[model samples]
Target: FQISYAGATDSSVQFIFYQPIIHGWRETDFFPCSASCGGGYQLTSAECFDLRSNQVVADQYCQYYPENIKPKPKLQECNLDPCPASDGYKHIMPYDLYHPLPRWESTPWTACSSSCGGGIQSRSISCVEEDIQGHISPVEEWKCMYIPKMPVFQPCNIFDCPKWLAQEWSPCTMTCGQGFTYRVVLCIDHRGMHTGGCSPKIKPHIKEECIVSTPCYKTKEKLPKEAKLPWYKQAQEPEEGTAVSEEPSFILEGWSTCSVTCGVGRQVRLVKCQVVLSFSQSVADLPIDECEGPKPVSQRVCYSGPCSGEATEYTPEKAELLYGSLQEFDEQYDWEYEDFTECSESCGGG
Candidate 1:
C-alpha cells in the first residue's frame, strides 16, 4: 500500500528528478510568489511520494536577485519624515526603519549650505527630493571675502648689498682721492641717537688744494739811465773833395737814317740821333719831370746805304701804296717789324 503527498505523483516525481528544468514553472510550488522569495527558485524532494508523483519541493531555497532593494514604509511608532509622493506634499512618519527621523513640516525646504554630516534631522523636503533625484542647487552669487597678501622682504648679503643703508642709527664714511670734492648727508650715528638728530645736511671736503701761480721777477740787478735820441737822425756831411759841379749840357752828335716797317708789310724811313749828356746833381736828385717832353720830328728811310728807292712816310695819304706793297711783299716773303719807342711831348724840350 502507498500514501500520496499534496503535490506529488509517482510519474511527476520521476520526471522532476530526471528532467533538467531551465524555466517556465509558474504554477510550481517553488516558483517565486512574493518579493521575499526573490525572483525564481529551484526544485527538490524531501518527504513521501507515490510512483505517479509529479510534484517536488525545495526546502532549502536559492534565489537570483538584483541588489537595489525598494524602500519600505516606515513604522507608525518611531518618528520620522515620510517619503515624498509626486503630488507635492510632505508627510511625516512615526518611525523609520529602526530609529526616529525628522519630521517634514514645509515644502521647498533648503538643505544645509554645506554637507549634511550624518544622521537625520529636520531638513527641506524639496531639497531632500532634489537630492534623491540626484540634483544640486547652485551656490548663491555673493562678493568674495578678500584677503590681502603680505609683503615679502628678502635678506641681503655682502655680495648683494642694498643700494641705500639699511639702518638709521649708523654713520657711514666714504673715501675720496686728492683734488676731489663730495657732498654727503649723515643721518645716523652709532651713539644711539636714532631720532633726535636725523636731519640731512650738505658736507663738502676737498682732499687737496688746487693752487696756480705765475713766476716772480728777480730783484738783484741795477742799471744807469742813458740820454734820449731822436727817432730820425740827421744826414752826415759829404766826404772830403767831393765837390759840387755846375749844370752840364747835352749836345746832339749825329743823325743816322733807319728804315722802319709799319702796318702789315710796308716799310717807312726815319732818322735817329746820338747825343752826349751830363748832369750837375746825382741822378737820384734830378727833377722827376725832366724825362717828360715832346718827341723830335723825323723822316723814315728805307735803305741803309745811299737811298735809291723812294721813301714813303707812314701817313694816311700813302695808304693805297702801302696796301699794294704789303700784298706784293707778303706773296714773296714773311716779315715782321715792331716799334721800340713811343712818346707824347708835353714839355718844351723834345
Candidate 2:
C-alpha cells in the first residue's frame, strides 16, 4: 500500500532571512565601588546585544525584531568593610563609623577703620573641622558643639581731640591815635600737641582795638583843703606870745605837666623857702632857713592813660641856690601828673 505524508515539502526548497533576533540580555562589569569603605554601593547596567554583529548598539536597533527585550538592573552591594579610627572623629556609640567634630576658629584682625575720631575693626570667624588626613575643612555653625566663638568686633585709635588755642592779648599799637592789637590763634591740644582738628566757627578773636579814651585825673574830694594854702599863711597859736616874732615857713609850687601822653610818666615841682612876717614884705626874695619841719617830696609816679607804645623819657635837671640863711632852706615840694591824651582806638575791643 502506497501512504503519503500530509503537508510535506521538497528537500531542494530555500528560505529568505533578515536581521538576527535579540535572544537574551548582557550586563556590563561592575564599576569601581562608590566609596572606599563604610557601607557604600556598586552599580552595573544591563543592555540588549545583537547576535550577528556581536557589538553594542541602540535599544531601538535591537527592537526591529519582535524578539528584542529591554534589560533590567544589575546592581549589587559593595564596600561592606568598617572605617578606621582617627582623632578627627567624635565618639557616639560603641561600634560605628567615625565622623569629624566641628570647632570654631578666627582670622587675623583688620586695620583701623577711621582716621581720627573713634573707629571700629572686625575679623572673620569660621567653624571648621579636621579630616582623616589632618586637613582643615569648613563646617556649619550648628556643628561646632561646645566651642566658644571669638568676638569679631574691636575698638581702635582712641585718643583726645585737638582744639583752638588763643594767646594772651598784645599791647596796643599806638600811644595816642587810633590803633589795634593782635594775638595769635592756633590749633592744639591740651598737652600742647598740634593735630589741626579745631573748628573754624569757634576760634577766638585775634585782633582788637585799644579801649582807653581819656586820661586819669584826681578828684576834688581827694585833695586836702589845707594843702592848698601856703605854709606861712596857715593859722597857728603860740602859748600866749609875749613878743611877735616872724617864723620861717615852706612854699610849694604847682605840679608840672606829665612827660607822656598815653602811658605812665613822671612829673616834678619846685620848692622855695619864705620868711613869715605878717605878709607885709615880698616873699619871692626871701632867704633860706633851717626850719624844723619835714622835707617835701619832689618825685612822684604818674599815669597818663592805659600803658601803650613807646615814648622818650626825660630826666629833670636839679639846681640849688644859696640865700640869706647860713644853714639850708626848708621848702615843701610835691609832684603830680597832667591829664592824658585820648586813647588810640575808637571802637572794637582791647
Candidate 3:
C-alpha cells in the first residue's frame, strides 16, 4: 500500500499469504453413521485445512507429504448399538423398535363383488412413519420413495355370466299321422339355480312339428276275405312309427258328392290313389313303380238322408265346382288304371 496525504507520491507496500500449519490433504475424520445402531458404514474424505485462514483449502496446495497415499479411505463399518427384533433383526431380543424413515404399508383386499360374473374390489394403502413403541403416523407419498412402491388398485373377479340350459326332448305326440313333440328348457345361473335372466331371443325351441310316418289304420270290411293286403294294411296290431322317408308313398283323396241333386241321377269319381311327397306333404301323380298300393273305391252311393219331396234344386254355397276339378284330373291322367294297385282283386290289377 502507498501511504500519502492528498497529492503525495504513493508509498510502496508488499504482502504475502502463508499457512501456519502446512499439513497436506488427508483423511483425518469420518462422517456420521447412516444408522445410530445396527450394522452401517461411515464415509471418510480427503481434504486439506489452512490454519492461517481458518478454512478448508484446495488439495492442489498440499504437496509436502509425498509418503501419504493418493487414494484415501472411503468407508468403514459402524456399530453404535445392538438392534431389536422389531428392527428386522429377529436374533436379538424384541423391543419397541422404531424406524426413522417412512415406508409403504397396505391393508388386505376386500371381497369380490360376485363369485362368477365380473366384479371389482380394492384395498387401502398409506405411507407411514413409526414413533417409539411402534406407534405409526401418516406421511407424504414422497417420503416412501426409498422403499418399493405398492399398487393401490387391481382386478378382482373376471369371468362369464349365467347361460341358458335345456333338458332331453320328449317323445312325439302321435304314433301315427302328423303331430307334434316337446321338451323342457330352462335358464340356469352360475350357482346351479333357475332364473329368468337368460335372453328371450336366444331361447331354445320346446315345441316342434314331428311326423309319425306310419299311416292311421281304417277297416275295409268290403274287401274280400281272400284279397291280398300290403304288409302295412294286414296288421291290426300297432306298429312303431318311423321318421319321414325320402321315398314317396300312395295316399287317398276323399270321395266327391252325387252328380245330380235329385232322383236316379248318376255320380262319377276319380282314382283316390295319389302320391304324397316326403318332408313337404304336397299331393301329386307319380309313376306306379314309385308308390304301389291297394287303391280305394273312387265312386260310392250318396245318401245324404232319403231324397225329399219336390227335390228342389238347392245350390249350397260351399258346393265344390266339379267342372274345374275334373278338368284338372283329366290333365293329369286318362281316369283308368290297369297296373299299380298292390291288391290282386282290383279289376285290371289296379
Candidate 4:
C-alpha cells in the first residue's frame, strides 16, 4: 500500500517515520518487520511517493477551495501617429480651421475648408471670410471718383442797331443799348454739365432794359442801314410871301407877316417901334422930339375939297392955332395947302 502526505514538512516527515507502523517489514532482521514492511521505509522513498501522489489529491481538494485571486491590471499604450511638424492640425492645435487665410498667393501655407462636412483646400493667406452668413473674402472695395464742371458767360450779339449810329457807338454799347443788358455762361470742374451763375465779372446788370427788333437771318440782313431823321425834329416854313417875321404880334402872335396900305387922310405907320409898343397906345403917346411933324388935329371937311380962299399971313401964333384946333373946315375958307401927302404916301408904300 502507498501513502500520500500533502502538508508534510521535514519535522512532520520525521514524526510520521518515528511513529509505530503496523503490518510493516524492515530491511534488517533486527525486528519482527522486514524492509518491505512500513517499519523499514526510507525518507527519500517517502518524498518520492508524496510528490506524485499529492498532485492527484490537490486536484480533488480544489472543489472545496474559494477563488479569491484578483484579476491582472491592463497595460494601455498610445497607438496613434504624431501630428505633422510643418502645419498645425485643426483638432490638435490651437489654430481655428473655420476661418479663411488672409492671402493665398502671398502665404500658401494657410488653407480652409468649404464647410462643416466639406473637404479642406489651399488658398491665399490674406483672404478672409466675410462676417455675414453667405458672404466670403473681401472686407472693402473701391469706386470711381466724380468731378464737376466750371461756369462760363456768353455775351449776346449787338449788330442790329442802325448802321450810322452803330459806327458812332462801341459794339458792346450797341448790343446792350440803353435798356438791355448782357450775361455770361457758367461751368463746373469735373462735371459734364454746366450749372449755377456766372462770376461777378461776367454777371449782367439787374436794371438793364431790352429793345425789340427783328432778328437778322443772313450776312446781308446784318448790314447797317442809312441814318434817318429822328421823329422829334423841328419843322420850318418857306422864305417867300412877305418874309414872315418870327417876331409876334397881338392879332397874329406867332404869325410871320403883316400887310399895310394908306389913302388920303389915312396912312400906314412904318416905325422902328418896339415890338411891345404895337399893342400899347399909351406907350405910343409918350414924348418923342425926334418925330417933328405937323401936330395931328381932329377936323371935319365937307364936299371933298381942300379949303380954298385967300392965304393968310403965316405967324407962330396962327400956326399953333391951326395945328391945335379941333374944328370943322368949310371949302370957302381961305387956307394955305401944305403938301403933307408925301409923308402919308411914303409911309404906305411898304
lDDT of each prediction vs. the true structure? 0.26, 0.50, 0.52, 0.25
lDDT of prediction 4:
0.25
Higher-lDDT candidate of 1 and 4? 1
Per-model TM values vs. the true structure = 0.11, 0.31, 0.32, 0.13
Question: 1-350, model 4: which lDDT tens digit per residue?
Answer: 33555564553322233422112211211212112211111111001112323322323233232442212222111212334555453223221232222222223433333222234444332323332133555421110001111122222322221111101111221122222222222232223333332244543232233443533233653243442221122122111222212121111113222122211121122222111122121121112221222222213111212334524433445434442332333223323433121112212221
Ranking by lDDT: 3, 2, 1, 4
- Span of ten consecutive residues with least summed lDDT in model 2: 318-327
In candidate 4, how many Å is residue 296 off? 56
Tens-digit lDDT track of model 3 for 87-200: 785342222233345568899988887765777778888988674447898966645554468886777667566677776665554566655455556677766776656777
Which 10-residue window in model 3 sums to the lowest lDDT? 341-350
> Cα lDDT for residue 153, model 2?
96
Query: How badly does each model clash, as a count of residue pairs?
Result: 21, 0, 1, 46
Which residue segments of model 3 deviate by more than 4 Å?
1-96, 107-115, 188-202, 217-350
User: What is the TM-score of candidate 1?
Assistant: 0.11
Which candidate has the top score in TM-score? 3
Error of 4 at 189 (Å): 5.0
